[model samples]
Target: MPSVPPFPRASSRTHSSPVYRQRIRHTVPAAGCLAVLLFLIAFGSSTVSAQPADPAEHVSSTEPSTSSLSSPPQTIAFTGGAWYDGTGFVNDPLYIENGRFIAERPASIDTTIALDRHFVVPPFAEAHTHRIDQKGTLEGAVDAYLADGVFYVANLNNIPAFANPLRDTLDRENTVDVALAHGGFTSPGGHPQPLYERLVDRGIYSDWTKEQLAGQAFHAVTNSEELRTAYETIRADEPDLIKAYLMFAETKNASGLTPAVLAELVEMARTDGLRVSVHAQSANDMHIAAEAGAHQIAHMPPMPFQHDDGEKWYLIPDSTAQLLAEREVSVVTTTVLADGFDDGERKERVRSIQRENLSTLHDAGVHLLVGSDTWGTGQNEALYLHGLDVFDNQTLLRLWTDTGRSIFPDRAIGRLAPDHEASLLALTCNPLSDFTCVEKIDLRIKQGYVIELPPQTTSSP
Candidate 1:
């Protein structure tokens, strides 16, 4: 395979920069707003453990418990707003106690936030991103993601040595929540191996040898033994999910995992209680992944129809669509990157095929999730913006909210329900009316900690 372009890297000097600099843009209120203060009071008095809990039990505790008279859980009521609770919108008063929604309001409310003529929905998730690397660090990727109203992100392509430390640091610092696939399984000299090799040559990953980088950074398994070793190595990292690549053999020089191997990998992942997300770019590979029982397809496959030069084009076949739906495999629609393709007849043709592919998958009853697959930098903040061109407002919203919940089902995200996390985005304009309204976030509430954003400034004409 030809050497891919050198991946961006952060200078060693950049690593010494204060981490606080990354979060400087976010203005944390000194005493917080009424809602936030109430939340803190309730959270402090509640019995909810700080550690992770089962999703079904994420709601407020009902068991009576003695607390100091000076610090009782405060009841806060949010009235006069339309809430999108994942499935539909409802205009009602939502109550919160101990950082969780409650069905009934307390006899006496401590505070109330007037939300008249506003829309409240769960913060979004970027499901198929790859910005957890060093370069993204310098770019303030995590902070940018949070500022964009993304509460959670799945780093699909990860290098354990690099990703795990970064993830741990972020977790300890209470930054953003990230679901990681700590290095995916790929065939020998496969899709990402060539790219990773380039990064090493550029001195980005100079510390590790090529063999050490393989499998951990980009697995290049050629047989069962290699696959076994790679799987165990990745498993040691305790990944949230497992990822594998399945590209057509003829399309590129690098060899891809065969259907049999892919199936085995899926079985291994499931046996270990992990979900598998396969990277497949063509109908043939997609079919293999579906049949192998992969839980998610990282990208929407190219249309089944082929051009005269053998490039795949047009919409996917009905059979494939039905199989995908039956398997209940969600597709992460990462079509935003396609916009970077050089403008030409070929680009338009590919774009048309991709648009049709996503629409057909959606129509086929397959869950569509949003992902930018971009570096989540200032320049790439438009990840969620461009998708509006192809999908309707409601569909895109669901992709960003509901479908994303499927990735980390145990987390209290993607919904505004009793026990769900209090992370939410408040907008003056209803997104259902015009999705662009999402860009105008009036307030961002994450884990009940509110951060009021500064008003957007329009560029001078």
Candidate 2:
């Protein structure tokens, strides 16, 4: 057992200077194998010790508590593997027990199942996936992630009602590390207005083509009281973090959250101990969110807003960079999301916008966490392609795996250190040397159970 869990708070940490990434190190827990049907059936359960019932009944409580408690949770160990060691990825032996890494060495491990001659990377995490839950049927789409080495997620807005079932599965089955947001905090009319009926109307404009929604982004919040109430309602769900809505510049009818209102929402969330993430479409919204002291800003500001008052749209301005550095606002670089092409011209525009923003922020020491929003295809998954130029493959893999560790400070997940989560993916070639190697997974081990596919087999139907 670890003397204590790492609690560095991976949300985002501002650095004094730019730092390149290293490889990933972690053990696969049951959470990593949620999609592996074979693994679940073979090693679904884990046993955690319980306090003795009473001195008279159990005496010293030293019976090891085997029976009644169920089988121990499965944990996978990757021996003779190379992965990120925080500063970079390296080849090393790894050991994991009960979903956590307990040890790693330079030589062979005594385990029967060895991950020799494989490139083990941390289980990938889609930081901004839509909400998912288990229905009664075993054939559900929830496991889509585990099949892809996704152990953790930052869920987008979904019904608060279904959080429990997913949480139960994650807790009991060790299937996923899910951090959900209450249904989105949007302007009176935004993305939610279309996806959800109650949220529509108020000129949210559902009739728009997919190109419009994709270009426009989510709704913008106009009313301060409504923003306050919405934040409260979502906070009541006890989410790991808060989601905020910023307006699209084109939606003049959609009044963006003013600095005061954004501050109000931030304050309310503060009292309740919630971190805020803003879906800012422009720089003004981005500024409001930062000024309000929100913890995480979800996107890279693309174009400059260029308000009549000289305010700009979305961008990581030098001033904003300085401010973010000062206030510690970590930006989730979802560049992959920009891959959507309205057409040849629009696709080029969006891609260009993302590239500009990304290069600037990266150079500015902004806390850049690599996320795809990929699980749902909002942004495609990262391997050697897509985000390669902006973020090197090695850097992307490291941040995707380690940065999602918003819960702990550089936990065992991001590095191949002893006593970390044994959640790993093995590649045919060294990804550190070439990011594309990640695209060629040779083996995957999540919490002691293999998905049983030839390195390239599908984990899903």
Candidate 3:
């Protein structure tokens, strides 16, 4: 088996519950078996099995059949299209088989797909988004993402109780892959607490009690001991990443984690073997998060200093940009969601600040990952439109493909290359020329499975 980092020793308090002990026993062995099976497959061994078998009786023969050893690989080829393989666009045919891209054509062809003048690019990644709904199925959200050629979605804010089951359902259905930051670390009455209260008051999750809501949505750490316990509790759910919220003190009616507490939380999460993603809206919060060793900035931070002449323009300081770049921390651009501001002037100012900050970060060599922070609906297209104001289509494509790959290095999702998953989007026109062409998605493929697009309705004349 491939070497893995040692699992952290859990405290007796962490495994105090019978249910927790049972989960550990079941999940650990299953995960270990999976790792061993994957290792065997990688090394070209046929000892693994789908079902339990007697190891001694199932030994492979030294002399294998010639036909079995020499059989040609199943091939599927796509002709007449330009492929954007993360770095550049190449006008050539691409081939795939067994859900992976092959360098050369196979001896025999199993299927051939004609692209005719379309642009084939890697499937998009929704790197930032919240829970689509607090109740019922996530089918609407999942379908919306898939329709927009987003095969992988990183749900930045999620309740473990809800996200875990939803992830399993989506995996079983083979619709979309979801990476969840199950809940987030925040102070009592912080950003999400107020938001969660509104959700409950609005009857969105009326069935949930206040205690349950707090348990699912907010970690609310006040001190070191609480911070440690929060880490253990959240880690027990096995989230893909950890999310920490850092709100400025100037924001009225909201409480937030102090810098010291935030730093401690980040350190504890890293020690537990999780990447820390922080939500920082203000410039100070952004600096604090970066200095605390966060792996990613979940949103573009607002500028700390504003012009006194009533101008909306704001610039990120060169020193802050350098710090982020030096740490190699990526920033997920959610500037598109600036439209949510109630004041028009405030909205414009925030947008201006985000654009300037994004430009600075990009110039400073910081990785910029594309994220919509909006629900997985028609908003996917809106994200592309909004991003055009700051980055060109080529850079935007890279944010979606190359930068996204860095977010999940173990998964083969965001690139068209050998040994990568056949997840891609076929656009009617080249997006590099006009980013708006993203809306004209001709087809979507996930893991070599073609997703049938919904038929368009014709209006009566």
- After superposing candidate 3 on the true structure, give the runs of residues whose Cα lies further than 4 Å from its correct spot: 1-74, 132-137, 249-254, 303-314, 376-388, 454-461
Q: How high is the CA lDDT of each candidate model?
A: 0.61, 0.51, 0.62
Error of 1 at 78 (Å): 1.7
Q: Which tens-of-lDDT digit does each residue in 1-461 have in candidate 1?
A: 11112212222322232221112122222122122111222222223233233322322232111110111224456655578855556765467665566677666444345454557778777778777654335225545555566667788877877777564334211245677887778776777888777878887764766767765777767678888888887888888898888776335543578777888899999998899988876766777789999999887744222233344523577678789999998887766565566556756676677777776787899887777676642123233334436676666676777744776787767778877766677666577776766655555666544443332312100
Per-residue lDDT, model 2, residue 432, is 60
| Model 3 residue 375 distance off true place after TM-score fit, in angstroms | 1.5
Candidate 2, residues 191-289: lDDT per residue as tens digits? 555565532333333343434432123334567756655555555566777777666533464444555666787887788877788777676566667
Clash totals for all models, in order?
2, 40, 0
Residue 161 CA displacement from its true place in model 1, Å:
1.0
Query: Candidate 2, residue 251: CA error in Å?
Result: 9.7
The TM-scores, one per candidate, come to 0.77, 0.69, 0.77
Those runs of model 1 whose alpha carbons end farther than 4 Å from true positions after fitting are 1-75, 107-111, 134-139, 169-174, 206-211, 249-254, 303-314, 377-390, 452-461
